[model samples]
Target chain A: MTAPLLRIENLSVEFGPRANPIRVVDDVSFEIEAGGSVGVVGESGSGKSMTSLSILRLVPEPPGRISGGRILFDGADLLALPRNQMPDIRGRDVAMIFQEPMSSLNPVMTIGDQIGEAILLHQDLNSAQRRKRVLELLRLVGIPDPAGRIDAYPHQFSGGMRQRVMIAMAVACNPRLLIADEPTTALDVTIQAQVLALLKDVRQRLGTAILLISHDLGIIADSCERVVVMYAGRVVEEGDVRSIFRNPAHPYTRALLKSIPRLDDERDRLYQIPGSVPLAGSVTQGCAFRARCPLRVETCAVDRPPLFAFGPSHKAACWVTAEAAQARSAAEASP
Target chain B: MARYIFWRLADSIPTVLLVLTLVFIAMRILPGDPAIAALGDNALPDQIAVFREKMGLNVPLWRQYLNFLHGVVTLDLGRSLISNTPVVNLLAHHLPYTIELTIAATLIGVTAGIPMGVLAATHRNRPADSAVRLYSLVGYAIPDFYLGALLLIVFSLNLGWFPINGGGDDFPSRMYHIVLPALTLAFLKSAFMGKLARTSLLEVFGKDYVRTARAKGAREGRVIYRHALRNAMLPLTTGLGMSLLATLSGSVAVELVFNRPGIGTLLISGISERDYAVIQGGVIVFALFVVVVNLMIDLLYIVVDPRIRVQ
Candidate 1:
């Protein structure tokens, strides 16, 4: 197979002193094939957002730094790219839509100008051409009366419409990859569905890969084809969306899936995970999720488990399940 | 917009009236009698009575107040008791000097101060930022009058770079004479503007939209100037209005030290001579300036920030 469009290998983002740093994103490894969708699902402080930010090198430094990473996008190592050249790649090749649509946009700038800015940065378009493109982008993102609303400030638009405008700007250059960091978290439930649908539609129309970061499993399940479940800065499980949802191997993943309330089950209280995620870099030598995992073993405390295969594309980072899967596979081969 | 201006103008009437009343009261409360000030302390009682009668001071206090109000409304400020010149002409002659000093000082302050602030903010916590901070600190610590004396001694006395006294003749010399006093006032004014702009720009730099602009692959200069600076201007506009008024007031002390004949010097002389007409006129003019400036700032708010409406 051809190389994936975006390959992130053992990316680590840290904060505080370098002598004893707090690693927010530790050894995060993932990839997105061209035009494919992947979701990084985790609770708050699980490093999913940092992981996405590291792709565009947008992490605020001094407090937070991408300490180590090989982010290879389109056969180039992004981590090694010069600071000045990075701008050329960002918004041109990899665009991002942030969580807060209300503040993400420049309050003083007109919507048309903001969207046109993205196109103007990369493309050699004149004022008229850029304006035309901006109008077209507005229409594509489902903003009504694109021409009339073009001159309106950010305060004029509602939350959902603002997100739509954000999406329109992100996709203006037809970027190869779109990193959406909880793009719909701030929207209403009904509006959330509309935004997610619009994202999917944009992905299809522009043929852009998406790295969706969200805490909500429902959002991930609805929008992404592949899922990477992260717990305390480490990926606990990653696989095809169907396999991971149906046969979750990591204890954290299983608990997360069970926590979702189902109308058919008729439960009195919605299931909740037993323990909160550990602070980053707190569990140095052991598994990050061991405190919260139901299937924790002695081995889990002493050594961190690597991603062990359960099938061709499904893997889980767990001492108990991964070892069991390994022994069962070996036994089947021997027989 | 017109309606907003009209209402603002209406609002200023009460303020002007209060200032006029305060000037009237303050003149009356002062120790020297108007007749004694105009004539002499040893004048005959009949002569004093004739002077009071002519000036309308012998009438009841209510009637005198009504006459004063009528004079204000009719723009009949009467002649200066000392100079015998019409108070309006005296003001018209000297008002230009104060206005020139204020405008020149403001121009210098904004032009110098904004760039200094931009530098300090962009290089926050760096050596350059520290240097700017230190400059502003020194600028604030020194009073403009003291600084004006130092400049006068250094540039005018020692070096003979400028003339020692007088408001200067012709447009060129006026520009020349304005430099020292304007600079003295501007020294403090720029310090204020620099501090204000630095704080405002620093706050805008931390906002989410600035980060968004950077994420859009905008050049650092573009992100700062196009996105951040415009937003920063809202607070800076308010600060500028206040600083302009401050500069106007500060010019008074600087004018005394420099011996330039401006409105402040005129008012001071009027106060010493107990020239009630000149004092009242000067106070009213200053009060009106305050009102007009505030109105202009309100108008500027609409231009700087689109969210604000005239209503």
Candidate 2:
């Protein structure tokens, strides 16, 4: 619709020597509508984190670089924005909370000073106003006794409470998009639920779109309306969460869903995908998942599959599955 | 915090006593007799005996040690055997010159080193970083005494910019004489500090909190100086404490090369003359200096790093 809040077009992140660099994130494209939630689910090294980092242009250079990309946020191409002006957009328009709540907050700084820093950067609030705002933010994030605990350091807070402080800092400026890279992966299960709920609540209250990255499909399913499934630096499947879960088109998506442990009576051995996802840049000229896909054909090895549409908004990058869907659709049209 | 300081001060008593004991033993165990060194070699046996008894050396080993400890506690360090001046007076005269030299060198080192370190870390792998690293390497490799000689030759002999020897009289002349020696020491200390700062800053830069600082859109300068530098300073401060002790010891050689009238010269002359009270007093002062410095560093830890602060 009306120019999705954030659009990533042909984004590619590479590392290593320039002559034969390793591409960590290759041709990833996604969109997040304003006030919407999207999840990127992938195994470690699947480029999901890199893709998210590229959105903010925060990827470590030298070793890591955004080799090619257009990150259009609102109407501006964030990739093309002047380096000096990036700070204006970062905490103000788009903020991020990392996976590590333990080490993410500055150890030497008090929680009030840290959360207040985010406000201080973008908002032109004086120190008193900033302190008042920080206290409010702390209360909003469910931190008890915002007054007494404001001066407490990161070490004094529990893991869950620290994450809440991080959340408070992230939302200090009311960013339009919040990129959470495995925000709950380091938390206890109960804490994870609480954090996820807090994130959802923050989104509802602030109307900030969320780009959630995680290796947990269940988390994606529960938190996201739409999901992008990435494998070996490429999106293998993307669609509304319901359709993708009900009728997963990509073989990797099917494998991921199958691997989820069920509470009901089931097989003695837990299901596992047959092979590990290939290392980024390891698969050069083929469908990245062809080596592990059970339904892979000759064409899958010679040529990479593009995202082929199966429905109005659902797409899958799989030679066999997309071709089968196309032929079935053609037969139905002929009838 | 006061309790921590009190305990820290109390903790140094044992260390100070251990140093005093070691000094006492070293004076006794070493070969030359204080009687012969203080008096003349041709002195009669009766005269030597009188000198030994006068100096309390005729007492038993345990008794001498107890007397030495008692004198130290009561601020009664004995007179220098050669100069016949009170050990406190000698220390009072020479200690200020050493302190002045040390403070000057330290000021130069910290001011030069930290900024170079920050620059090198921020521009890592660039020409600036390589240049700073090279400077640090050279600084570490070259001995301060040799560097002092070279500086004297170049700046004093060739350039005629500074005097070759002697601690100068008056504030301005003292500052002028200090420049070369301070530079020689500062070169090495700054190199040490720069290397430490660069390493510490580099490590802090990679920390998750630093990345978080960046994501919050803090300007580069703010991220580096405010966030990364403060975190990096804890290790640097510890390193600084170590380096300060090193500089203290290093000053002995530099002082000899420069021929400045400092505690180093006093100690050297004391050893040659076997001035037991002078040597013992000087060694105790050094030991106490070390204790106070280490104590200050621990207290500094509380100020710089909140994690180490007493709850």
Candidate 3:
């Protein structure tokens, strides 16, 4: 069997004072195989970004620190590697496309200079060679009039074009895994689709594994083959896209799935998960998702549920999934 | 751009007229008579009257102002009351020295202070940054005269490196005399300039693009200079504009303290002897210098930023 490209095991990140470092990502574990796509769906305050930032060791220091975890890229412990070695690993091994494209790009620099800087830093290319490669990278990213557009500033480009430039920069080094964090959030719906298609096309051409983080269920549903549902700071559910879509096991996942507005005969009142993602102190013991979980039993509040795999692939962290989970699942599916 | 330059030149005309009017009125308003200095101290009222009539001081203030404006327009400043030399000739001789001094001081401040600021800001929270901060603190606290004296003692009097005091006999000799004085003035302004550089750079480093640069595997040096430092320098341009203003004004103090023969000496002597022509002409020229320097600074603002230039 082919080995998985990326594996994150028991990863946790904390920020604030050491004595009581606020746990932002708590024991989150997942894996993505080569050329595979995974979507991490969560709300604004969820640990989605923290998890992504940890992979590249790009978390801002002083308060934010990766407390515990093994970020294994092809079974190598990424967290153990030194910073000098990591820069090559970052853009060359795992590239990241940030959410705010305009801010992430150097405003004073031209589009060509900014893109060429990536090549100049990591590769041994002279001015003429880097210019050729930079122009090629701009062309490959589907920028029209690539020769002329290379000299434009960030402000000179429209919002969509700026994002395309950002995409071009990220893929300039040709990494295997691309982590796109809300890549389409700042764009209009039409522009959002165009950018998303550009990302999808690039992934297909390069055969790069993509960890797409988004709050938009439609984008996730359309883009990812597998999905990891996070609540508070922990993974609440994980499954193949078809299984998760057809039958969501955890009540939080169920509520989330139901909440997605379907085009056909949708209810006038859209379904919403009651209450917000729970506060840290409010759900200190047991499962972090228990307060919002509709299937909260006596055992759920006191003792957390381990992720029990019903099939070879599907897994859900819920107290109801015990020896009788398969029977319970079939009974529920029978209408 | 053509329209803007035309407007600026047109705008300057009224300013020159206003300054001419003010200087004419002020000379008349003062208590002392310029004719007194022209005549002997023990002269009678009749001698004074005769002296005043000959010197054109007996004319009414409005008529005197008109004559002053006419002379200014004609490019003829009448002879100095005490020296009996044309004010134009004296200014033409002394203005170069003051200009050279101010320019040297400005160059020194810009060259030395920007690097110090960049270094201090980049090395923030470290000992080097702390030391720069401390040095600048000491620099800002002390007056320019005391510092100039201290420098003179260390470099000229003790080490015999620079000339002690006096104007140069020639251009090269004048430059030798100017080194200590220019450096003195530069050193005074650089404390503020350095602090401005480092603080602005530090602030720029905190911006999002700096992070973006670093994330792209940019070396720390290039990241700070290309991405952070360039942006940081925008605000420093504003400080530099104000510094030019301060530099011209500070020449009076620097020239006075060092005894280098420039406008400062002319100004002080002009005031003491109450030589209205010398004082008025000198003040008017210095005022024009300050205003023109400010205009050049405004023009420089456009050069550094294209967006500003286009607007």
lDDT of 1 by residue, B1-311 (tens): 66766777788788778878887887788787888887877899999999788778988898988898898788778899888898988989999999999999999998888889999999999998998899899999998899999999999999999988778889999999998998998998888889888999999987877777777788878888899889989989998899889987998888889888999999899988878788878887887788778878988887888777523
What are the runs in model 3 whose C-alpha is more than 4 Å off? A262-269, A278-284, A320-335, B1-75, B167-172, B309-311
Q: Taking the tens digit of each residue's C-alpha lDDT, what string does model 2 give over A208-310?
A: 9999999999999999999999988898899999999999999999999998999994789988888777877999997998888899899989999999897
Docking class of 2: high
Which residue runs does candidate 2 get wrong by more than 4 Å? none
- After superposition, the stretches of candidate 1 with alpha carbons farther than 4 Å from their true spots are A330-335, B1-6, B28-33, B36-40, B60-63
Among all windows of 10 consecutive residues in model 1 chain A, the one with the lowest summed lDDT is: A272-281
Instruction: Give model 1's TM-score versus the native structure.
Output: 0.96
Q: What is the TM-score of chain A alone in each candidate?
A: 0.98, 0.98, 0.94
State residue B180's C-alpha deviation in candidate 3, in Å: 2.8
Model 2 CA lDDT for position A49: 93
DockQ of candidate 2 (2 decimals): 0.84
Candidate 1, residue A256: Cα displacement in angstroms equals: 1.4
How well does candidate 2 match the true structure in TM-score terms? 0.98
- Report how closely model 3 matches the true complex, as a DockQ value: 0.46
Q: What share of the true interface contacts does candidate 3 keep?
A: 0.37
Predicted complexes: DockQ each: 0.72, 0.84, 0.46
- Residue-level lDDT of model 1, residues A2-90, one tens digit each, is 99999999999999999989999899898999999999999999999899888889898767899997999998999999988888988
Error of 3 at B272 (Å): 3.1
